[model samples]
Target: MFNKGNKGLFALVLTLFMLTNFVSNAQEGESIFNSKCATCHAPHKDMTGPKLFEVRQKWEEGGAMEGSLHQWVKNWQVAAATDPYAKEVSDWAPSAMTLFADLTDEQIEAVFDYVDEQPKGGAVADAAGAAGGGVASNIATEENDFGWIWYILGAVFLVIIFSVGGVKRQLQELDEDADKQVKVGSKVWVFKNRKYVGIGVLVLVMAGVVWLFLGLYQIGVVSSYQPSQPIAFPHDIHAGINGIDCKYCHNSADKSKSAGIPTTNVCMNCHKQIQGAGDQVEKIKNIYASAGFSPEGGGKYSGETEPIIWNKVHNLPDHVYFNHSQHVEIGGIDCKQCHGDMTKQNELPRVVPVEELNMVEGNIQLTRPTLTMGWCIECHNVKEVSTGTLEGKGGYYDEIHKRLLENDESLYEEYLEDGKVTVNELGGWECAKCHY
Candidate 1:
């Protein structure tokens, strides 16, 4: 009886240990989903991919869950061959999901376990709600600037001071001339004075030179240059309120040079279902009209579709080469870093103020930075490349870092002491990186 009790106690302890391991693995899977899949997929909602909440159920009921799940995760193409279940999921999402063949069997199992435990409707709604809040906050912060009021007040004060000084000077001159009772300093006499004439000419020449240099510096630069857009699109509604991902609208940043404008078909994907106008919807409808789409009835016309001619806001000189991918993909710079909170802008306004002196000017005023070569180098020198993580995956810089640590002991020790290698240290300031 004592032996039986001992065996039972041991079995209970082993069961508890296994359960704890399973829970830990499931939590890690959630982290993985948050980092990578959350951008495109959701547990319940049919987003870029199928509703993942019922993925396990679909796979299990179809009789290919275990083996197909393993293979589909490793390589979709390989798994899709014999796996009818995998094919069904793929058919739902026409766009091929990027394969994560590198993940181990254990990791894939953890992901499945996480999918099984996810609460229906709750996870998707919560994620969408959080994203909406972030967009709204960003828009609000941008719109609340008091810089323009201050600028007008300063100009008014300067004008008042100048007018007062001019009146006082005129009165003093009149009194002096009356007391003297003589022709006080004729215009010709003043002009003939070598000292005064020399000073006048010197001032004019200096002003001309400064003006010429300023014009040359501003030659190709366009600051505060808001042009009329085809669609009077309000970022506040789409990005801020609706909570669309910037990447969704500007999809090419991940894989290509340009964040190419969304095609008309992309617009129809959502706009077709939602035709009712709420102030900004008419603007969105204009985009449809330009693409030869009639919202009244009938489907898209087969005739020549005139693409909406959007005036590009951020224009770089032909000589300069700027790649959206390099900054976005490699450096992981946010779109808001350069473009400001576009969600707050109600109308497309011309950019002004050639040089940005502060965050107010740089972000709100839509001013171009004094983008001299030195200024570019200075930014690169200060900015640190976060070798911490890549799009929520493990840091891609880790391999290079490991090599540096193992091969160069002194350099590794110094880097550890400093806590980081700045962009400049990693040759980010090199001319070729930007110029080429």
Candidate 2:
């Protein structure tokens, strides 16, 4: 019923509408792909699963039945039974593909459209593997790398001394009356300046003693000592991005002597679905092996387990009776107070340097190296004890608070003159408190 010009206009509007819809679908598909499919499958790279790029076309070219690809996405096992091409894909890898039963046919098609649009060479691969290792394995190497700088300076100093001595010798040889002057051998010169030499020797011996003492003081100082673990756990990703609480993994921090390493069962809670992509594929596979889990047949426990031997990061002397529960639960100290801001930590867990710990916001500034006796003593000297509202709680601090208030009024008044009670005033400085 419409004119030829009107019909042409209608066709133009329809084409524009379809193009806009396609663009919208592709954008939605990108979001879905990142949140769900990114854990296992990549657009162009084969990770735990095969590459998704051009997969729809490949299925079609291989004579796949209509709507079978969408069915394969929804439930691959059902698709493999009905379609010959889908069955071939089932045998593509030892690990089975994760089923997306929640996705609609349109969403499944949109995912394919998104995958096909991705550039084949590397962009897709790069984008897919975005959440890679937060910290490098060799990050600790730079912390103790100042020896080379000292070596370079020493070499420069030797060069300057030699150059000056050579210049002086040249000037002496140029003198016409050089032979007329009395020549003194090195031994004769030393004998003439014996007093100065004795002073210099004393100074050198004193300096050597000081240097030796400083070196011995640093014998137990383990700042920035990060050990290689079975799996490179990314604290930035889990704690920073995901906002997982510290207590969730180190469950015994408030109850035991040590903040225990999390078991594989705890890892399986989330990783059962997140199989991982690119470089993370192998790391996640190690977790799977430890947990006795198989991604095949929509993920299951095969009961064939392997232990992940994780190297301990922190260590203390046998004589030190440090209790994790006493400090964490009673003191109410934040993990960051000692551990630094772990949320932004990119590398493997290491003994955080005192300088780095001091830099963290709200942390008490201390000069002593981390994990040293001096560091603990410094913390106790300044750390305020909470005595409020614990009168009837029968807690250790409550009893101490009662004694301060009731036992000695003059001593309590003197202690309060500094504004608050410190751990040192409440027997924290007692040798037996930390020793026995």
Candidate 3:
């Protein structure tokens, strides 16, 4: 409560302080409302939760218990059991609203004040959504981006050139001081030490040739490339906490070469009821808008729809032959072996680097970068051939192992010395195995 004073200077200062405090609280309340409450409770629209505009008046008019509304924000269960009006509010929805036991009474009042102050829709909501996306994209793009590496390399090269030029100038000065002829240019200096210069040039030319081929090798490799997606999906929360298998969303992995992108109906399987939390609700709204799903009373498909443009994450070249079904089902390779542990991934799908993939506890360690031919070949060379691991199986493994022993005993024993026959020992390293 604010205290009142009668005197001139003291009263004026006290009034100014109270005004400042009120403004600060108002701003805080608005921020809290936008972050926590705005998802379900809007000012004008009755969304997932009821429209909260002047809700306090309605509660008070219906004879709410003193400070029960604030207590409800703190914990709905306790409020519902103790307060009659809060009990009535609990039956408003079948699913329970998320508890906000962390918010204080002052904060709750501020949220209410903030919600009341909002002038119903459009510009404000749009601005808020844009601001959130802009901030999130900037931060995430900054984190995993590699565009800065070239700039850093350029700066390093500039420094080296300056340092070398400085050293050359110093050598020229020393030659002048000693009354000896100074090599005025790079050509003159090279001529003076032609043998050493020739050797150095040869080494540099070989290095450049190697670098050119290495750059050409990486043309089709997409290691950590993450493109922007319309919806920000957190794989960690879904795949990790919820224990949803990769095959659930990517159902075609066991049947087809391509693991299909999930349709909007797949999203509706859960989001028909679970409207999501925070800014995620708006993203879900995009799905709803595209599916032409109206969730006013319950939900219904209007038979009109729009498309959601999803960029491909992992793309293989047309010339390369990679089968998802063969690797996932027949070969018994885990998705984590190639995709990294998606359970820990929070951002949109990215081409997981080989270094990160190797760091996964059970994954096979490899030296080459991800999505490169060398990387694939390296994996095939170390990954155990199913023929060696099969104990009682009477399929391809049994026939292949029998043939290896009967036809080529020496070669079979040589491979057996390592105790693990690799895929390369099978036709994995053959030109047609991947190239075709």
| Every model: Cα RMSD to truth | 32.3, 24.7, 21.0
TM-scores of all candidate predictions against the true structure: 0.48, 0.57, 0.54
Residue 343 of candidate 1: its Cα lDDT? 58
Name the regions of candidate 3 deviating beyond 4 angstroms. 1-217, 387-394, 405-411
- What are the per-residue Cα lDDT tens digits for candidate 3 across 272-307? 998878987898899998789988888898999977
Tens digit per residue, CA lDDT, model 2, 39-115: 57776677777888898888899999999989987778899999998888888875555556768888777777766
Q: What lDDT does each candidate get?
A: 0.56, 0.69, 0.68
Candidate 1, residue 64: the lDDT equals 79
Model 3 quality (TM-score): 0.54
**What's the best-to-worst order under TM-score?**
2, 3, 1
Give the distance in Å from residue 279's predicted Cα in candidate 3 to where it truly belongs.
1.2
Pairs that clash in candidate 1: 223-351, 223-352, 224-350, 224-351, 224-352, 225-350, 225-351, 226-349, 226-350, 226-351
For model 1, residues 187-293, the per-residue Cα lDDT tens digits are 33432353564455345435543543453344223345454454666676677778888889899987788988888878877887777556757776676676677
lDDT of 1 at 189: 48
User: What's the residue-level lDDT of 69 in candidate 2?
Assistant: 89
Alpha carbon lDDT of residue 23, candidate 3?
Answer: 44
